[model samples]
Target chain A: MLKISGINASYGKIQVLKNVSLEVEEGSIVTILGANGAGKTTTMKSISGLLKPNSGKIEFLGEDVTGLRPDQLLRKGVALVPEGRQILAGMTVLENLEMGAYHRKDHDIASDLNKMMERFPILKEREKQLGGTLSGGQQQMLAIARAIMSKPKLLLLDEPSMGLAPLVVADIFKIIKEINESGTTVLLVEQNARQALKVSHSGYVLETGKIVAEGKSDELLNDSRIIEAYLGRKSS
Target chain B: MLIEQLINGLTLGSIYAIVALGFTLVFGVLGIINMAHGEIFMFGAFIGVMITSTLNAPLWVAFAGAIIITAIMGYMLERFALRPLRHKQGVSHLAPLISTIGVSILLENLSHHLFGAGNHPFRASFAEISFQIGSITVYLVQIVIFVISIVLMITLSFWLGKTKAGKALRATAENLETASLLGVDTKRTITMTVIIASAMGGIAGILVGMAFNSVTPQMGLSMGLKGLAIIILGGMGSVRGAMAGGLILGLAETFIVVYGDSGYRDAIAFLAIIIILLIRPQGLFGQKIST
Candidate 1:
């Protein structure tokens, strides 16, 4: 489980995430949904320690993880498939996956790599091709697969559905479900509230760095206010 | 005579290429122009001289010591000088260039103060020997230096291609944030990059010292300029481009030195770079460089 309370983040003088709080239970998909500039991405970044919070407490698996560097967070089995699918463009598909397990000392990396290939058969075909050359949908899958390569306990996905075709988006969400079912907790950030809520166990709505609503996925999906503001229902 | 000139040019070209490799690698990866890189190259030669003379180490030991020491120094510079400027991208871009220049001046003065201003002949006993191949005379020292340079390049290529650390370095070069998210220590990776680049420069310094049998404080500045030319000619970040550019520059300089005029050697080398840039600004093998 991961717990974050009273987290504040900023870029220069402009504050991004103000007193934001959230939680993710073990082996469940927890999504943060918001429109543009709702500080969803910033929240994920703060949890991953890419952006140091001015004041807050972040607990990952019952330990204080605030202010840890991104790499350190990864070593402690936390990984993020960052926004825009920042795949290493110059590297090959195999090398990118290898990068995911960089902190591990285990000798079964080859087996794990093969497992990733089995999960995403398309990647196996392009193992030797440069990552930049992959199609957008493939790149998104590769990003998530690459994250799973670390054997992470908590996987933070920011906008995985962005810029992909509908079919690819469905395929990616299916894999995310399978990944969650196989015992990894996921913190997904998305503007696609409909799809995100469909797969998530729980969801939260963020507005201007503040948490506005939180509950079970189906409840949030059908709530009159949630449907009006986020679920695309016209207001009465 | 032509054969002799070609061989000589290749050897010298390889040296320039080595230094250029350092320049291009650092510039390509970090997007920082480490003006201090030349000083690091100079320090390598000085370190070589110290190991061989003061420590009474053998040629191989001196060479290894020079690279390792310079690498550690490069890591230190990245950790202390560059990492602090990470948040300020605009400032970070210029800080390394300025700080590197300051470091270069500081080293040049330090070398002057410590080793004295006089030029020192770094005479390794190996310099006196040579093996003749027909009309072409190959000094054992030159052969050794060439072999060392080739071996180092091969090792670097392999390390960049086949190793975990290398993959991580490339990842960082492509996207630092993603690399960190994937469990790569971006700070450490950048430091490792500086170390590798500085080590390459260090080896270049030793090769130059042994080949020419002389080392000076200001020599690095000129050599550094030549390295920059090689990188520009080869394209900024392409590894193959660096080697090819270095060889081309070397051959051009050699031909000018032999057939055209001695004084025109530098001029011709620089002119060739301009011509190449005008024609293919990204060099022969490099991708189009983004400003």
Candidate 2:
């Protein structure tokens, strides 16, 4: 449902994303697996229009969406749960979720909010508490719930498992799978290759702004080279 | 006599609170100290004077005119002066602050050219009217100013706490990127912040003009400096802090006038702010701005 073609993005004098291209099919979780400085977050930012691409095109549902601002992309049903779970710190949990539905004109927001509360009960428990006061895992849940509150057609998740405990990571991954099964396409960027590939249908390996490998998730999971490089398997 | 001075202090404090509210609102939403804010307040006072003198309008008309005119100016200031500098390369985070100072200078010069440097007195009908309560005298204008300031502050707090747009604004203040990703039109939110803030300044300006019976091109500087002190004293972006800070500064000034040397009012008021800052650093109601 989303196509990024040959996009190059830079921050001032330093070029980060160099001729990167990827496609996310509808109804599938497509993850970009990469190490530190692999331009995964940059790709997400470029797609979300937080960063203007130096060159190339981004198409969302066959529409040219390159250079559109984050808010504009959000209105077009694209939402990003950014790295570090950038939840609005000073806002209450309920207010943060309300913010997710900021651009909506529908009256069913109250219902959707109730649904979100049911899905993430912790958020409901802390609905009145300031978002900054939440634990890291709770904040991640809050961020995901905040993203989903927009009722996004395409959800871009950048490092949802970052800084969370392993058990919480597993839980978050399970949630991501469930979110994908519910028919919202997900573009996940992660350093956790095993969990990311396990949850995703398709995956791409990125190294230093270049996508080096692209294949079905299971195939890449067993691919000897990928296993060695990403899954931390030492070749004997 | 003490009660009279207390009332006088509160009236002045209410005016400062109104102006400081404008400063804090902009700072909260944009994270920039809008130096032009005081100039906007000055513009409001001039607009009040112009509307009253030229149009022969009532106090309400002048209030409304000042708000409308300064609100538009605030929007323009954001759109032109502040927003463009936001995305420029190598632009220091301090650029917007400095640019606003330039805007302030430009505004002061423009008003100086338009209205001259002399203090323009606003001849409100209620300026001379007073009622005695026990031994204390209360001017009708002072009561009006205090009531209006309180009403505006309460209304603002209500809007911020209860309304959807208000929540969006608070969210924007908390995290602009996250708010945008959640589908908030952050540009519009910032614009709304400036409009509301500038309107607050305008109202304060009109009230100040009516209270002291004088409006001048440079009036905003002194009041604006006090406003800066108020926000710093209260906490940079805390609404409650600004309100309390305003009253504290006003009371400090008035008490100094009553109990201490009248000439030491400004000095002592500012000294209290410094002492508070040295002690708390974050102001009374402020949270440390998280990185």
Candidate 3:
């Protein structure tokens, strides 16, 4: 389990995440739903160690990991699929996946790589091709697959559904479900509230860098009023 | 005589190629122009000369000494100069480049103070040695420079493509954030890059210095400018492009000096770069990145 308590993060003078707190139980998908500039990405960045929280604590299975750099968090089995895909454009898809497993010293990397290939069949076909050449949907999948390659205990996905087709988004949510079922905990950030709630065990609505609502996914979904009240005009 | 000229041109090309490789390496990783790189090349030459003339060391010792010293210099420059500028909040993208320019100026003046801004004659034992290759005379020094240059280039190419460290470097070059997210210590990778690049530049100074039998504090100015042309002509971040571009510029300059005149020598690389950019803006081996 990962616990973040009242973390405030910023980019210079501009404060992004103000007193934001959230939790993710092991082996479950926890979704953070928010619109643009809601600090969803910042929250993910803070947890994944890309951006250090100015205040508060981030505990991974009960150890303080706040202020640790990205690479260090990766070694502690926390991996992040950052927003924008950010795939290595010049490198092959295979190499991107290889990069995911960089922190591991285990000898079974080849087997794990094969498992990733089997899980994401399209990636296997395009293994030799450069990542930039892939379609948006394929790139998102590759990004997710690449993160999984690290054998991470906790996977943080920021905006996995952004700029993706509805059908592709559905496929991605399905893959996230399968990934969770197989035992890796996922912390997902998305704007697609309906679909995000559909797959997630629990959900939190983030607005203006603070948590506005938190509950079981079904409770949040079944009560349209609660979703509408917190998510405002953005939730569908 | 034509064969002799071609060989001489190639030897010169090899030196240019080595110098450009250093530029390519740093540019590929940091995405910043290190103006100090040229001074590193000049210092390498001066170090080699000092090792040879002052200490009376062997040619190989001079080469090794230059590499080690320049590599350390590379580390210090990156650690002290570029790294701090990199992390400072809201710093302009041009900040790192400007810092390098400052460092270059400091290095040039420092070398001037120590080496007296005068050209020092290289003291290689093989300076007088040469052999006949069927109507062409090749000096021992030229062969050494060419062989060393080629070997270093090949080795560097191998290391960048096949090694894990090389892959980490390329990954960082492609996207620093993603590389770190995937567990690459990008900070260390950047430092390592400068060290390697500086060593290459330094050793190149020796090879070029040895070939010309001279060392000067201000030598980096022209050579660094040639390196910039080669980087542009080769494509901004492509190592292979730098190598190919350097050789092209070197050969062009050599043929001009042999067939035309030495006065027009320095202008050739830039002219070629301008022509190449007009034809193919991406340079010879650069990828077309959308701005």
Error in Å for residue A23 of model 1: 1.3
lDDT of 2 by residue, B62-173 (tens): 9999989999999889999999987789889999999899999999999999999998988887788999888789999999999999999899999999898888888888
Recovered share of real interface contacts in candidate 3 = 0.75
Model 1 lDDT per residue over A35-66, tens place? 89999999989999899999999999999999
Interface RMSD of each: 3.4, 1.8, 2.0
- Give lDDT tens digits, candidate 3, residues A115-184: 9999889999999998989999999999999999899899999989889998999999999999999999
**How many clashing residue pairs appear in each of the predictions shown?**
0, 0, 0
Of the pair 2 and 3, which is ahead by DockQ? 2
Tens digits of lDDT, candidate 1, B35-133: 888989999998888888778789889889988989987887787777777777357567767877887898889989877777878879878787778
Comparing only chain B with the true structure, the TM-scores of all models are 0.94, 0.97, 0.97
Question: What is the interface root-mean-square deviation of candidate 1?
Answer: 3.4
Among the numbered candidates, top DockQ falls to 2
Ranking by DockQ: 2, 3, 1
For every model shown, what is its TM-score relative to the native structure?
0.94, 0.97, 0.96
CAPRI classification of candidate 2: medium
What does the lDDT come to for candidate 3?
0.90
Candidate 2 regions with alpha-carbon error over 4 angstroms = A234-236, B289-291
